[model samples]
Target chain A: MLSRKAQYAFRALTLLVDKYDQGPVLISDIATKKKIPIKFLENILLGLRKADILESKKGKGGGYYIKDHPSKTTVAAIIRIVDGPIALLPCVSLNFYEKCKNCDQRNCGLHEIMESVRDATLGVLENRTLEDLRTGKETLAKKG
Target chain B: MLSRKAQYAFRALTLLVDKYDQGPVLISDIATKKKIPIKFLENILLGLRKADILESKKGKGGGYYIKDHPSKTTVAAIIRIVDGPIALLPCVSLNFYEKCKNCDQRNCGLHEIMESVRDATLGVLENRTLEDLRTGKETLAKKG
Candidate 1:
């Protein structure tokens, strides 16, 4: 499952997607609608901007907007920016990984099994884009 | 996607499973091997006992043991006991649900799509068990 930060980021991004083509949206407006704290949201948006998931403007009438089209964005992208890893275990993680502390054996059985779950999890999360999530489109095509 | 508690519980249960029919394991043994904090694991074990996933004895040479066969105990059952809902969104939830805060329509497109993802996710996690994890079997079954 996603973390609170990831959840809030998705909610914020969805709000942005709902209004992206409509000029910039104030962080306050998004926070108010999303029931997230404005200060905390500002940091979240800042993180998103740093990751290039969003672009921000300052001063009056200035706010944040998606740098990429919603359809081009994936929940995996947002999750990576916010939570750092899609894989549950460090052994299977792409962006963040280290040898499992408990794994001394090169052919550790636990790692092998976790890798499968990891691949399945990443397959689902990475393939589904923001557009898929927004439109409720079944993009993966494969049945579980 | 599992919590520290769930992850610890799963590891502990798997350890017990690995030592199946060897008699009960000491809490200290599980905690040390699984790298879980002793105090926190105690609480988790208590909760697992209440859920009937495990049974405990109070005397010396007694700690914890799986109540049922490892294959019979699905990861979902353990997770549900530790984490409230498997789905990321309440609208996507199977057992626990509340209306989406911003959406008035149950037929909202977002709800429909997330539900599918949730179902797919559940299908995968719920079917996996400690036995599968222990033997590292069915690794290819999850290939996308």
Candidate 2:
């Protein structure tokens, strides 16, 4: 399962992407729109800003907006920023690789299957940008 | 990530599949072999048994063995049994589906991407079995 934090990140991103041309939106508005707990959302937003996914502006109209263009940002990027590796096995993870204790990757039965899973997930996630998500299409990757 | 319990389940299953032809093995043997805490493993095994994945035999010269043939049991099945749904989003899960609060699934940006992720993961996991893990070979599913 995606952690609550990651789910919140997706929700927040969706709203921000939709309102990208409307200037910064208040944190309270985003929290309320997405129905996320305000305190929790504050932390999530901070992380997103630190990751360079969001830009926070200060002053009277202060709020947040997408720092990265929606076309360039993938859901996988958001997930990794908030939830850590997408792989089930550390050994199979691209960004969070770790040798499994007592594991022989070459001879391990789960390795091949787990690798396929990782590759398959990457195939989907790496291609799904915020723009595509915002439009909610049937996936362009399928046709290509 | 797979939970500690689910990882332990995989480790336990792999070991048992390796020793399948040799007859039932002791829970202690499995725990010691996999370095899983005995008490923790005891609970895990009970769940697997209840799910009909393992057949337990009591008394001397009797222990536990795979109830279902390893070749026929997918890792996906084990994870679902030990860890619940494998889908990243609750709304996309086949067994654990729930409407995302405030979500319009048809227009939700996260829905399509999450569904693709779930489909990709299931595509890989549903095809893998313990026998494939025991000997550690390229899956025939890959060729087909």
Candidate 3:
């Protein structure tokens, strides 16, 4: 399941993707439009900014905007930034590997099964970009 | 990510599947083999029993055993039972749908994308069974 924090990130990002090239959007506007709590959104946006996925302006009409084109941002990247490993088991994680205290990954049945699940999930998340998501089209990735 | 509880549940279930029809296996043996805390394994086993996935026996030669053939249980069912919904977002969940406070599911871009993700994930999880996991085989469900 997506963490609440990650969900808020996606909600906010989708809004920004919609408003891309239209100048910065106010945090208040995003919070209001997305129905996220203003305070919680503040931290989420700040984290995204630091990750270089978002940029912010201060004072006057300044707010937040995507740093790169929405088309360049994949859901997998955002999920990793906000929610860490995409793999359900740490032992199977590509970027966030951590040996399980109890099981040997080499022979663990669950490890083998979760690896397939991880690949299947990444097939969608890695291929679909914020632009694709914003368009809300059936442009699902063709399996390679 | 899979919760610690769910991870433990999988570890325990895999052991029971291996021992199925071989007579009941002691809780202590499972705990030691899987490296789960005995008290924690006890509760997990009890829950599986209530769910009719496992049956418990008591007395000198008693323990726990899978109630059904391992091949009959899919990974998706286990995850749902132990960790709740497999969908990343509640609004996209088939069995555990909930209205998003901020967005209309019919129009939300993230909702559309997540629906795809949920489908991709279930492609692997809903098809693979405890038996498949036990064999550590690459019998991943081909996209249909």
Candidate that scores best on lDDT: 2
DockQ, candidate 1, comes to: 0.29
Q: How do the residues B3-113 of candidate 2 rate in per-residue lDDT, one tens digit apiece?
A: 889888888888899888778899999999889999999999999999999999899988889987788888889999999989998999998998888778878878877
Tens digits of per-residue lDDT, candidate 1, A1-144, equal 556676677778777876768889999999998888899999999999998889998999899998888778776677888878766567777788866665443434445555655665566666666665443333444433
Residue A4 displacement (Å), model 1 = 4.1
Clashing pairs in 1: A1-B1
Please write out the lDDT profile of model 2 over residues A43-118, one tens digit for every residue. 9999989988899998999999998679888878888999999998899999999999867787777777788889
Off by over 4 Å in 1: A104-110, A133-144, B32-35, B105-110, B135-144
**TM-scores vs. true structure, each candidate:** 0.80, 0.94, 0.91
TM-score of chain B, candidates 1 onward in order? 0.88, 0.92, 0.90
Off by over 4 Å in 3: A135-144, B135-144
Q: Which lDDT tens digits does candidate 3 get at residues B15-72?
A: 8877778999999999998888999889888988888888889999999998888888
Docking quality class, candidate 3 = medium
Q: Which candidate is the best by TM-score?
A: 2
DockQ (Cα-based) for each candidate: 0.29, 0.66, 0.53
Write model 1 residue lDDT over B13-108, tens digit each, in one string: 768888877889999999998899999999999999998988998898888988888778876677788987877677667777766665644324
Which digits, one per residue and each the tens of the lDDT, describe model 3 over residues A1-144?
888999999889888988899999999999998789999999999988998899999999899999998888888989999989999888889889998887766667787778888998898889877786574544554333
When sorted by DockQ, best at the front, the candidate numbers are 2, 3, 1
